[model samples]
Target: MGQRLGVDVIYTGPSTADASEQVRILEDMISRGVSAIAVAPNDAAAVTPVLIKARNAGIAVLDWDTPADESVVDYSVQQVDSTVYARHMYDLLVQNMGESGDYAVVTGGLSAENLNIWIDEGLEYAKVKYPGLTLVTQRIPSDEKQQLAYQKTLDLLKAYPNLKGILGYSTPAPIGVAQAVQEKGLQSRIAVVGVALPTDSGPYLEDGSLDVATLWDPGKLGALTVYVASELLNGRAIADGQDVPGVGRITVRGKVIVMGPPSDFTKENYKDYTF
Candidate 1:
């Protein structure tokens, strides 16, 4: 999208998903006088001060994937509607759990704004929509690591013998949950569902450990983010329900542009997606 727009795009990020690294990178970008900046923040709060600095410098700053302070960024882009995505995960869990049962949640990080939005939305929706479903404990934080998620799942298994479902809020969280379920041979007993990459989730999907892995196409999401940034840079307003190349229609509400809903990658179709 950047190439098509004839805009110079230089992609750089933290070597690890660390908030301090992201702040340093943003400082470098601001110093370089970049025309526009879009970030999928690792920790929204940690980067807000830097983003405010960017805004003051007359550099267009936007949030993609994860949101920062609303006052800082020009506009925000979301790959999917948070409410819809969260409810969908809950619906998947209830459907696969054979009615409704005790379920737990695992998240990437407590500081991730996007993850919390989904988890909070799902919790609210569950109380009204599926009253029979019970959350066994408070949501566990995995630090966005598969190994940590794996160990957390193991501990949950030992603590709650009747854990019927697990809703993983991060990419690595679901894969790790599925791994523990597979190892325990509890596929039929526990329903594992969450957001994850199809490439990384294929084996779990093939087995019965992971009932459903849901997410939007990151390639399309990246293109949409770049397109949105380019449009903002050109003094063009992103109209609601605007048709975008490669990404279809986008819904714009206030300063937020939502791409669409998520895609559920299951054992039957995980092979079709390469990323």
Candidate 2:
């Protein structure tokens, strides 16, 4: 999309999980005088000022995957509505766990606004729709690391032997949860579900450790981000239900662009996808 739009796309990210580094990178991008900037923030609050600076400099700022401060970015590109995605995840967990049991959430981190939104929505939906199900613990932070999530899941299992389900909000979290369940020989007793890359979760899905996973196409999201940035740069207004190439018709609400539907991957079809 960048090539088609005759724009140079410069992609960069922090080498580690440092929001300061991410801020530095964005500041550098701003210095480069780019036409636009698209980012998935590590720390939404910390990056807001830099994003605001970019916007002030006449750069189109777009948020994707996870949103930064709404006041800084022109719009956000989301995989799906947070409420809908959360309910879908919760429904899948409840279905696999026989609709009633103790469950816990494993998130990327407490600072991830998008993950927190999903967890909050899932909790709310569970309270109303699945009253028999109980959330046994508060959100467990995984730090977006598989090893940490594995250790955390182990601790949760040891703390609550009767834990029946785990809802993971990050890709690494679910895979780690599945590993812990498998290691404990609790696959038959516990169910794990989350947003995971099929390539990462395929083996677990096949072995019955991970019951299901859901995600949208990241490639399409990247292309769509560039397309939207180009549109904004060219002074084009984004209308609701506008058809975006590569991504289907999108819904514009406030400053957010709902990308499209998310797909569920199970053992039966996970093999068909590589990313």
TM-score of each: 0.97, 0.97
What is the clash tally of candidate 1? 0
> Candidate 1 lDDT, tens digit per residue, 1-275?
87888888888898767999999999999999998899989999899999999989999999999988888888999999888998899999888995577889999988899999999999999999999888999999998889999999999999999999999988999999999999999999999998999999999988889999999999889889899889998899999989999999999999999999899999999999989
The local distance difference test score of model 1 is: 0.92
Kindly list the per-residue Cα lDDT of model 2 for residues 1-275, writing each as its tens digit: 77887879997898755789999999999999988999998889999999989989988899998988888888898878988998999989988997888999998878888999899988888889999998899899988898899999999999999999999987889999999988988888999999899999988998899999898888888988888888888889888999987788998998999887789999999889878
Off by over 4 Å in 1: none
| TM-score (C-alpha) between model 1 and the true structure | 0.97
Q: Which ten residues in a row have the lowest lDDT in candidate 2?
A: 10-19
Task: Tell how far residue 9 is off in model 1, in angstroms.
Answer: 1.9
